[model samples]
Target: MRAEWVLSSLSQALLCVDGEGTINYLNAAAEQLLNCDHHTVLGLPLESALPLRSDKGEALKPALLNELASAGGEVKLRTSGIDGREAVMSLKVEVVRGDGGEPAGFVLLLASHATASSAAAEVINHLDPLTSLMGRREFERRIDNLVNDAATSSRSHALLYIDIDQFKLINDTSGHGAGDNLIKAVGECLSAELFAGDLLYRLGGDEFGVLLCNVDSFEAKATATRLVRAVKRMDFVWSNISHRVSISVGVVLIDQYTLERQAVMSQADVAMYTAKENGRGRVHLYDVHDKNLSRLHDEMDWVHRINQALSKNEFCLVNEGIVPLGDNARADACRHSELLVRMCYKGELLSPGQFMPAAERFGLMPQIDRWVVQAVFDYLIANPQLRAGEVMFSVNISGQSLCQESFLEFVYRNLRRGNVDPSLICFEITETVAITNFSVVTRFMERVHELGGLFALDDFGTGMSSFGYLQELAVDFVKIDGLFVHDIDKNPIHEAMVRSINDISHVLGKKTIAEFVESQVVHDKLAAMGVDFSQGYLHGRPVALIHGAGQ
Candidate 1:
């Protein structure tokens, strides 16, 4: 009775048959697998519940079952499915002896062909030919099981996504044969370092997945770090040329909160990409509270929101005036106001701080930039007096939008359609954006200048190559970074830095605008440094382009 109870609890299907080949009992697994009720099948012929056939596709006779009980050996049989399909199942038959040492009954242990192939395959499936580790299919199956178990019970696990860094360079410089050898070597090395309950899977070329059971965030992070170091230390030699290999690992904790297998794996993949982006050969933990990940999730939500906003015209344009500082004739001639964008949500005005980060991260900036430009152009056309006043509206453009060929065409088309003078509009590109895409930005600036539009390198002195690229980019204005101007009056170092930037801008024949000028002291200091313009709360806050524009 105890043995029968144990069999009933087994995940694999089990059955007890009498000496006459009549079914006596069926476990829960057997009932589910065969799609029959145990009470209904009891005392029935074994063949009635599961129509078993020999491996050769012939029906198994009673004599064969009796012989198998007598000999006590396993047999492979084919079972008929509900849809008339055949599925291979393995039957390990054990004979039960009576007191007189005669055959009494048989205990059958049943399993699917894939799970019963070999001892190793029982734990996994379809081991990789080269690495001898479990393949992608088995990995996915195990992850599904983990997810299901987590839904029922409280347990924690962690998944590590490992990707070889600069793997393509090795393949391109050497050959495919070398790449194959390196893969095998790395797989072997990693497999050797795994713990007892851990599993390593080769998830296709140059990528692997490690399922670490019963581990928390700290342990998982430590394991990931060790794995990274181990990969970096691997001595890979191909064709007498030594190759160094490193891996980026993304770690994500799995628990009841984990939505599903696909979502968990996607989280790991995102963390891995973050590691690669932050300079490879590192481990990144998937923190729900992380600003970037939070922004990422918010970005996905905002993608739809932004599209809806554009269609429904939920966006508003505002402007902040840039006041002249010092006795500069050019500053007096240039009437500048920076155009800012805001979104209307739930009957309240949402500043750029709330949604622009999401837009930038999710590549929705181009669409938003186009909307801003079109709206600005429309406003200028409606208020011809503003255009005739020679007011230069410095509209900020995203780096992504500025890099696209279509954006330039869009700008030109809108200018022509609005019949607005290009000189009255100045596009603002950040210093970092200008420096990162120097050549592209240079060409863009030249084209804009040809169209009579001016360019301003915004947030100056923030990028590493700001000074170098400043000489290359053709712009009319340079806005000093707010960080330098925020406390320039109190901090001598900041004051000196602002002075240096101001002097350099004058040398380059560009007008300087000091940002974050919140007081008369900061504004006066900038004026003392010959800064051409000042913008902040001290000058004026951003107001709607058209008055009485409320959400």
Candidate 2:
């Protein structure tokens, strides 16, 4: 008893067991380490303390007693106790040789550390320690391995890349602890569903990946369905707050005959982006036939070029002429043209088509808008003879800029500094942009109106659905979209759209201008429609700012 007590006090874990592998004694250190009192664990059988094996009572690994009897000095093996929580144990077993020089029973003195060394840490680092699931690195590594294996074996594997929908919003509203719990729940649910060969990985922050080896197309699809269903059924709870999480999955089967494993993975990535584009919570297979990826690459490149253009001041605005509603009505009156905006880039004047959509996507619309405003002001300041009343300059505003109070403030300060008469400026905002944020639009329009400014809803007839929203916004003027005016000469529908819009504007007590009036016939057709004003190449093309018509 004294020897047992002394040995138990000297080590982290010390236990005595009979030849039948039943634990008879456990000392103070073992109880303290395992978070149990000695009295509770003392007489518990070894298998009962750590029930890792099934009910059949089979040991997960060979019994430590058999090994200790053979090698009496130091024996190293892994074992777990107190509900299968792991520990690394180095056992120094004392084999009491009987008078016959045969081993009696071994007294095992054990010391342990729960932590692992750096080498083991690196391996498990690719696995989430809490759930023992693959991480991003492990996911990728396994995928790579499977790809190589398939190449040699002439088999195929599939990768399912998944993104949790609206996870950021949830994470922000809930605490990070909740986010962590949610992720752990997902990992657990996925682990429960996938078989031994399939691997689930959390690829950091609401994105996960799975590598399914030896899975064909049908099996891959079925696995994706299983994963989606698993995620759907899981109600992640943290702090008693529960929420459902859904996922969008993109799958790519390795084409070992044609592409490398990395390429196959990249194809899946592109497909994942497509799934996101088509709205979330659906699975999409990688379609190699689609050229959308090429277009996306080009668009990204174009976005970068546009940003560079803005930085280098490589873009300029051209002023198109906007005449009065009745300027050409009398047929002989002095026709004063209102200034319209066009853009010049790389020493060539480009229409709005060249960059507007790309600009909107890259969030460069506000900067482009600011540049337009500044350009008009700079031109007016430079050409002193072009007085405030000489011509009204129409500058376009982007929806993105309108949503920003900082942009509004900046516009106000710049306009005030330039001392440009606000009334001489006709600010053109698209109906689409104005209707979406009515409150901001109302406040901005009111502020600009107080400054003696005028606002025109450009592209008006395009969203004919917004008549009620238009009345609610109540701006100074409406410029019909060029689509209706461009084909008025040929398309009777276009003619009717213009006529209806013009009449509606007149009824609302607001003015309407016909855009894209490229010919006298179209201009005359609009005039007959009672369109207030006409603007296009017919009046004049956008030109560089001139003092007096390039004199």
What are the RMSDs of all candidates, in order?
9.5, 15.0
Model 2 C-alpha lDDT per residue in residues 1-551, reported as the tens digit of each score = 24552443332466666555556676655554455655665555665664333223345223545654566665444555667665554556565556798655456565553322243666666677655666777676566556655664556778888888777666767977777777777778777888865767878777788877666888998888888888888777766777878888889887466356667766666667667777766787876677886565456556667777778876765556676545545552423344444455657666678767767865678888787788777766665655554556677788889976778998888666746778768787898888777789889888888888888898986664668787777677788889878987889888887888889888888888887788988877777667778888887776665533521
* lDDT (Cα) of model 1: 0.81
Position 532, candidate 2: lDDT: 74
Candidate 1, superposed: residue stretches over 4 Å from native: 1-146, 153-270, 281-316, 325-335, 342-389, 398-420, 461-472, 483-508, 521-530, 545-551
Highest-scoring model, TM-score: 2
TM-score, per-candidate, Cα-based? 0.53, 0.55
Question: On a 0 to 100 scale, what is the lDDT of residue 307 in model 1?
Answer: 77
- lDDT by residue for model 1 over 214-318, one digit each (tens)? 668999999999989888899999989999899999999988898899888778877987888799999999998888876555555666687788889999988
lDDT (C-alpha) at residue 377 in model 2: 73
- Model-by-model lDDT, in order? 0.81, 0.69
